[model samples]
Target: MSSSQPSPSKSAAQGPGSPIADAAPLSLSAREPHVPADRLVAEMVPPPRFDSVRFDTYIPDPKQPSQPEAVRVLSAFAAGLGSAPSAGKRRWFGKKAPAKATGPRGVYLDGGYGVGKTHLLASLWHATPAEPQLKAFGTFVELTNLVGALGFQQTVATLSGHRLLCIDEFELDDPGDTVLVSSLLSRLVESGVALAATSNTLPGKLGEGRFAAADFLREIQGLSAHFRPLRIDGEDYRHRGLPEAPPPYTDEQVTRAAHATAGASLDAFPELLDHLAKVHPSRYGALTDDLRAVCLTGVAPVPDQSTALRLVVLADRLYDREVPVLASGVPFDRLFSDEMLNGGYRKKYFRAISRLTALARDAKGLVAQ
Candidate 1:
């Protein structure tokens, strides 16, 4: 939800006199959210959309046996956490004892987008017996950003107290992330912090096409050792039986709808991109605070890889918040260029397109004929 204050005239116009004026639309571009370090750590729980999701609420596709099996395995994994030795569990000499991990201590859900991996990951987080503070959940980007904000040792001190750490959309995009996350997780595991993750790529294959992964095989392999890869095979559930996304609306239509809809945000796509660059990706969630819908005009293809990646993070935050997106100009499928779409980050781009399309569909009801 954007915190951008509405213009005085716009606010006055939307004042209590008229029903349409009772609620003012927001502008995403106008907000520059600054999140503090402690807030970031406190907000690591599952996004609101998944706040209440548990294993029982997950509806697995009958066609995909792997789907149901993922649920079963994850359920058992969460249960096992209750019995695992605590971080301070020690040997007779007052030294720490190695985790009695019968097998891989963590589980990795590897699947394409919309395969309910996130749902399962959140479910596991909720099912864990520890208090909310003892279990942490966040995206891979947020995890890395936490390290950036809190420093490696401080982040470990913070999260090492947790009994479980659930990472969604886990990825290793570069050698730096490869080394950072590998070292971080290794320390956490030694502290007896249980780990679980979900991603399109398997643990071993992470950063494959995106970078010279072979150069970091040792680090990558060390990271992989922390998790038991659980294969989840299924179609993207977002488009499984849904109709095609509605076509773009006219700018006038978008603007008009933004005025009529309470808490909706209106912005030109290009301006929004520029704004996102100024705000850290870690603050994207705060940037969308209280937003009902996102309305964009003059939507066009992203200019370059950096901009596209930033938009992907924004798209993810919006999707996580379940904020509808109403837009004019280009459709989401055309947001990325062919070269970018076919490049190493294709999976990320595709996921963004899928998520944005779903949000677009969610916003169709906000438009008027």
Candidate 2:
């Protein structure tokens, strides 16, 4: 984990009244994570942050009745998956599509960011009566990436045996994804694989303003049929009782802290964003292996949509790992342009801001006053 950049000299830190620390730091830009297909499938379980979460651990906001109701319904749904499917029903290949399920085969938790939808979804995953291998959990992007890594048919064959699949941050921003996932889930449902998902958008409402969704109505409708929607209403819980995120520290402070902190990675913000563009979104998790805090100097607004989306994925991985972010220059709120903020992918951008802000709060102690 040696840095790609040179270590700041000890004299720099000792310079008349400087708070700089004198240790070398790791560099994220120096690492190019290679995630094999097998690893993608193996890592489909909940991210570290939610690995230990369970139904009882989700404290439903007393004011949001839907929160508790979601838990109750999901708990029952998990219980319904207690019986394993017969071996004959395990295979999804070379079979006629089974009869349309009499009722919804899945539960979709719809809510705003930080409403604990992910927590509840992961809780259901943990509560489900199945072995870890029998259950799978991942974000929508990861699911699609898995399909891309393993061809669509292979993806179906691989997941068809699972008793349950939990999808967090479900989205339909692209038409191809709508078609691919709808077909995949249909096969899974036919194989008796129960499903649970969480998203900022409801199943039916996904892709409304993101694309030419009208043309994909059939695919969208078919996808919606597999899930029963449950709405949870509440303020963004990340900042509900938390203080404002600390302002960006000085570049010297950020660099000093990166050097001082073990397992911390140092990078110029712009270079890190450029590095992200070259890495596939699915491998972003791997890009952060064994790292502690992320220290970025010259934080600024993303130049365009593609880069912003990549950053969103990185933010998600960092938040999933509960890694603190220490940065200089512009804050997370200003990371996207106003046009991007008002555009179709606004929810994704806002969620990134929320998560990054939380990580920034976690890094306040890294800055030397």
Candidate 3:
């Protein structure tokens, strides 16, 4: 599969011959340029290290969640739940916490891609108070890479920085990952880090894929031992397209976005923005800035208690503007399509992403016409 990693068909305009490289060597360069010009030019370009690593690579905010309403929900759940790990102790009691949820408290984000699972998780990380020292991200793919880069012991040592972790996209994708997942959780419990995740599949989705449904079930049976799963119920926000957040001015930004992203249908977007901009155009452009910040930075910093960072801000923008968005994706509002992943090891992830094109088209104005 790595052999088939897609190379960028297009490239952005960089300095002549491109002055960037593996970044590692260039980063250590002395104040003065000592390397020969020939070598400098030759080493300035290196294919990204993660060319074959998709699941763990950084995602642009356009492809991830960008608002905060969901973060508050998860944070409240976490606050009420506390940091004491329960999977081990619950085994002795042979019972469960009978309070808020019937199943688990750990957040479950089940939906089409670009709807904001990662965004929601990131927001929760930023929204949650500093008491637990929550460290967001450190996704499954990233964790695997860490284990590869640094042995398991060193990986665990790195994770020791935070007591609370909001893990994004966690599943036993492969045997290697299963070992890591099992080991990570068991240790996190020992260290006391609450887990929160966004997934396309429910617990049972894995076993069905491998035809080892029994072993899969056994692995996850108590996986939610300390928490319950919370599903992100909705269409992909990305499909909804630039929810009337901010207005674009110059052609360059829009052009850059279009050139960098393939098959994004941004041509169809300006007209959509034109229609909405006519209604809610503002001079301050805070909403636009917020939206653009997420898009440009590719990282939506969770706002304080007063606001959210996910695309929900756009939802609010539309709500305030009195608009509503509709969906056109795989329509999981009825079917659990996430249950079917065509790929192996990481089925839910592939399935969730596969639903993206549908998400962009399906989102309609949240406000009624």
Candidate 4:
């Protein structure tokens, strides 16, 4: 397809730096159909009317620029852009423009998953219309695969022209990921781009076990020099979607599960279940209200690694300055039938739920679905 007509001025003897001029026209041949350079460019850069953009453009508060917390964050983020040596060098603050960050603002917003982590940064992009910039969305995984070869360079060019950079779901699940984040972020910061990211782990918490976490932490800590850390405390905004998740649980399942284990002692489990509920209230509420959906019944024991780790911590709390006594709660059911999971001080995180349930029998009370 043909590109948008060049501006009248641009149509004149084209300058060397013009993107159109730089691209050689396609050479069509009998053997193959020529794809337009403009088409290729179109695919690489998102349009203005994208779903993310439309969703992000609402200023939660427009007066004095404070409609939403994201707007406030954007204002703070924008102010930091002013002090950035690299951002200042571009002098983009005066004009609505996007530029690469040889210098980038690496601010990470870490918190529990599904806590509107992505939405908060998204709101910043939508609210910062005064500073027009290219906004792209990518998770840690997507970035990892693209940080090398042509991917990183092209992404830079596409995003650089814009003054602000927004990244979402910045999880660091692997060691190699931490190292690359450091190298790339260092480059972006040097280029002078203002970056805002959302994650479920604190910058200090990232790559906790990985070799590169130290470097990642060192690089990110410098963010104190620019973007300020703002903890967003709020309810999960996710369930507010047009089509919300199904109701947490069915009535019959709850009653039946409750009736099935009326007299069971909940003494086997302790605060183990409580903490997960505390830190992840909605998830926990959903879990308890609908644990059967994931296949569960009554008070089960903590089996496998995930529940086991939780179990050990609970055991410590219950037995704090006291004797070792069985606590109670619904854990995984797989532990009872699985001989492999029968005995062990070490908690294997990935154990079967069934095993955990068999162990839950020690509880003083049993809960229904």
Best by lDDT: 1
Q: Per-residue lDDT of 290-343 in model 2, one digit per residue for the tens?
A: 778899999999999999999999999999999999999998999999999888
TM-score of model 3 vs. true structure: 0.42
Which stretches of model 3 miss by more than 4 angstroms? 1-72, 78-105, 131-134, 202-222, 241-341, 345-369
| Cα-lDDT of candidate 2 | 0.82
Candidate with the larger lDDT of 1 and 4: 1
Local distance difference test values of all predictions, in order? 0.83, 0.82, 0.38, 0.38
Q: What would the per-residue lDDT of candidate 4 be over residues 63-137, giving only the tens digit for each residue?
A: 312225645555566554543344433555564334543332555564433345455565555554433434444
Judging by TM-score against the true structure, name the best candidate: 1
lDDT of residue 252 for candidate 2: 94
Q: Which one wins by TM-score: 1 or 3?
A: 1
Tens digits of per-residue lDDT, candidate 1, 272-306, equal 99988898999999988877889999999999999
Q: Is candidate 2 or candidate 3 better by TM-score?
A: 2
Cα displacement (angstroms), candidate 1, residue 2, comes to 9.3
User: Is candidate 1 or 2 superior in TM-score?
Assistant: 1
Pairs that clash in candidate 1: 1-288, 1-289, 1-290, 1-291, 14-21
Winner on lDDT between 1 and 3 is 1
